[model samples]
Target: MRWWDVEALMPLERELFGDTAWSAEMFWSELSHPETRWYVVAENPETTDVLGYAGLLAPGLEADVQTVAVAPHAQGQGIGRGLLDALIHQARERAATSLLLEVRADNEAAIKLYSARGFERIAIRRRYYQPGDIDAWVMRLRPLT
Candidate 1:
């Protein structure tokens, strides 16, 4: 992801993730991190407006999907799926044997998306989220490699 995109993504991050949204600086740092792999701004192919973004961090054979979000107005347009597909592809290419991520248990939409992508719940982190004290579902997907 480029530095220019961080400004645009920050608003969407706040809208979708509320208190969990990462700051622009965090995005910039991740973009430059050696272990971070990010795919940002999927264009319309014709119009070329950025539709979504996804990120992953692979420190070793295990990878963690740090975040994935699509524009609020662009939801349900398959942009999320495309971004997720790219993340999984990158993980495989990086020789990551397993992919991991934590999702708010209350976020059914996100849970469904991850499950459809073959991430199975392996554990639960009780009270993992603040304010509401919600649980986080820890999910993992094994790569074919």
Candidate 2:
């Protein structure tokens, strides 16, 4: 993602995540740490519309999957997988020995996606999500051989 994409990215973020969505300033702060961060966006080729966005933070041998969101109309079209793949690639590029992420316990689809991508449950963060009693499953993809 570039400086210009923030304008288009924030709206989709709010639509997918609602009140807890990351603010514009938060994105700026993340981008400021390019040495340890990588973010990417997918767009409609014809209209140049934002379809999805994902970010990764690799600090040392560990990498965290910070966020992955897809436009409502664009879900189930491999955009999420593509974004995830990009993150995994970026993590490997950054010399991350393994990758980790957290997903809401209720989000089976996302959990399935991550599981299929080699992430395995390692722990749980109780009541990790706000405004309710939702929990988060902390998953990790083991180090590559």
Candidate 3:
């Protein structure tokens, strides 16, 4: 995603993630690592509105799905899937042998999405999300073959 997109992306980030939303500085920091990081923003084909976004960080043969989000109005429209596919493609391009991600266990839809994409639950982190007691599921997806 371009630097210009961060301003537009932050509101959606807050809307969806609430208190756990990332800050502008965090986005900036992630963006600064272009060699190891990749991020994409999905825009409305007609209106050019930011519909969703995803990010991946690849260091050597290991990669992580840093973030993925679809606007409330844009969910179930294949945007999330598209974003996810893009991330996988990016990881593959970087020769990532495995990809990892953490999803809040309570987020069933997200879990289903990742599961459908072949991610397997590997572990559970006890109350990983702060400001409340929410467990997180650590999931892994092996080399895309």
Candidate 4:
């Protein structure tokens, strides 16, 4: 995603993730390192409002999904899947053998999405999410080939 999109994405990000939402500087930092990072945003065609955003980090043979968020009103419309597919394609392009992501344990929809996309739960990080003290499921998709 471009620097311009950060502003447009803030409201949605805050609304969806609340205390866990990323700061503007975080997005700027990620975008500054385009060589190892990829971020994308989906927008409404008419109003050009941000519908969702996702990011990936591929520094070596293993790539990680940094984040994936869809506007609540736009959920279940395949935007998340499309964004995820983009990350997978980018991981393959970077020659990554595995893709990893951490999802909140209570996020059944997201877990199902990742599972359907070939990611398997490898472990769980206790109290990985702050405030709510939620657990995080560590998932991995290997053999990118």
* Candidate with the greatest TM-score versus the true structure: 4
How high a TM-score does candidate 1 get? 0.90
Q: What is the lDDT of candidate 4?
A: 0.95
Top model by lDDT, which number? 4
The local lDDT score (0 to 100) that residue 30 gets in candidate 2 is 92
What's the C-alpha lDDT at position 25 in model 2?
90
Tens-digit lDDT track of model 1 for 28-110 = 88888755565556656787566677888977799989888887778888888888888888888888899999999998988
Show where candidate 3 strays beyond 4 Å: none
Clashing pairs in 1: none
Count steric clashes of candidate 1: 0
TM-score of 2: 0.97
lDDT of 1: 0.83
What is candidate 4's lDDT per residue for 1-145, written digit by digit as tens? 9998999999998999898889999999999999999999999999999999999999999999999999999999999999999999999998899999999999999999999999999999999999999999999999785
Q: Candidate 1, 42: how far from true, in Å?
A: 2.5
| Shift of residue 5 alpha carbon in model 4, Å | 0.7
**For model 3, how does the per-residue alpha-carbon lDDT over 1-145 read when each residue is reduced to its tens digit?**
9888999889999999999999988999999999999999999989988999999999989899999999999898989999999999999999999999999999999999999999999999999998788999999999675
Candidate 4 residue spans exceeding 4 A from truth? none
2 versus 3: better lDDT goes to: 3
lDDT of each: 0.83, 0.92, 0.94, 0.95
lDDT of 3 at 11: 90
Q: What lDDT does candidate 3 reach at residue 49?
A: 85
